[model samples]
Target: MRIRIRTKWNNQEREVSLEDTVSVLAFNSWRIGMQSLLEIENENFQTDTQMQRIAVLEEMMAFLVHLLDRIAYSSLNDSDREALVSAFAVKLADHVHDNARDFAKGDHRNNFINKLNIRLVDYSETTWANIAQEPGFSMGLTFGNHIADALGPRDKKWVLDYIQQVLMPEMVKLFKQVLARLGLINNEN
Candidate 1:
């Protein structure tokens, strides 16, 4: 039986047609999108600077979040959770070394000792954890926070209810809420 599922993001409503299995379609869409990323030829090693590497990592994580948004919460089983979590770790391990490339921007020139330092610094199991621990990597953690998905079946109901409700609202209300806390802008405007 085919059914239409409606999802909204950024004030846009999308309707996806399900052919008997919603999870089946979700899995295939994610797989195809990631596969295409791999096919693109990597630029020179020289071009793979720290910023570029972080952007690449963000792209990968963002894709996962997008995938989760599509799939039904009940469909995510223990096996699926394990696979997805491990996928993040494995991808982190693969490209962590890419940061060794010389700085492609700024005045920081490539040096032998700096290159060695990048190699010697062990990233442990969680790069996100490492980033969150330090003040210097604030950008990384802020982005990492948005991209990280730790939701399981237990937390799914409230998230889909409360969090999804927030997304349904207009952006102006959300922007004012953020600004009100910082005291930069006032509601009187």
Candidate 2:
């Protein structure tokens, strides 16, 4: 499927095919989430086990999917938006499940989907719009809270600050560029 996006220059509109874009985004989100995980681990965040690290990665992927959904809201119709996000989530789940099977087993895909569903509910309740066009405080806080909960208690106190202050903003900025480049959203947004 293809979605149309409005551009800044001359207010012209362009199309982006969701077929290839969704797969690329799935991989990119996973890669970036892993990079973030590595950064967090290097910072002495206590993800002591592979399971905990995988959980954190799933949280990051879910957040990216939610952000992408919000960014596409203005451009795509409801059905198209649902299709894009759903497909993205499935692909992300597959990536997570496949990578996690070595240490974690028993329907990791469904587990990821379940967690994503719960997170989606929480995210939906958060204010998508604020005085600034960026993601509202509630969204970031909710995400930070999830990641903090997934990490070890020793570093839990610092995880929220790190996630909200450093990690999320960096991921948002990166995805914003990716989305714009894909014509999923305009640069100005």
Candidate 3:
């Protein structure tokens, strides 16, 4: 989803600044992550309870955070990339906390953030498949493991294939489109 930014600067128009763009990207990431979670739920991915649902959503957010970090790597310097991913993760944490607070116990925001940090570190050790330009085999497997854990025993058989083939590819396509529209990346990337 595209975000509109309203700005006023002495009646002179300027391109959306990087800060504003980062905010918009983070917002869109959260929106997209939520949508993805709903889609997965509809597919009967086993988010039967509120805690289960929140766990799935947290996994989705972590995947998105890592994916966004990878996408920004080619286009942004280290500090800028870190800032963008951090902001995106914070926004995701806020959304998760808002949605999960009543159902779950204790510090959802910090919990999600802390888990996200750990996920980022773990996912970082996995390779990025240059040929496919997406998460490598290990990364996708790891994400599948996370989803499977969140989903419990049911649907475990197909989770890995679905995540590696359907989920990750679709998310990459969506994020790339968003970044391209925002001029952070050209269409080719």
| Model 3 stretches with alpha carbons more than 4 Å out | 1-12, 15-19
Every model's Cα RMSD, please?
A: 18.2, 6.1, 3.7
Q: What does candidate 2's lDDT look like per residue over 1-189, in tens digits? A: 012222233323544457667876776677778878988988888888898899999999989988988877878899999999999999999998998998966899999999999999989888777333467889999999999999967877888999999988878876776677666777864
TM-score of structure candidate 3: 0.83
* Reference-based TM-score, model 1: 0.23
Best by TM-score: 2
Question: Which ranges of candidate 2 are over 4 A from the true structure?
Answer: 1-17, 130-133
Best by lDDT: 2
Q: Where does candidate 1 stray beyond 4 Å?
A: 1-56, 59-72, 98-189
lDDT of 1 by residue, 106-156 (tens): 322223224323322322212232221211233233323322222223433
Clashes of 1: 0
Ranking by lDDT: 2, 3, 1
**Cα miss at 68, model 3 (Å)?**
1.7
lDDT of each: 0.31, 0.82, 0.77
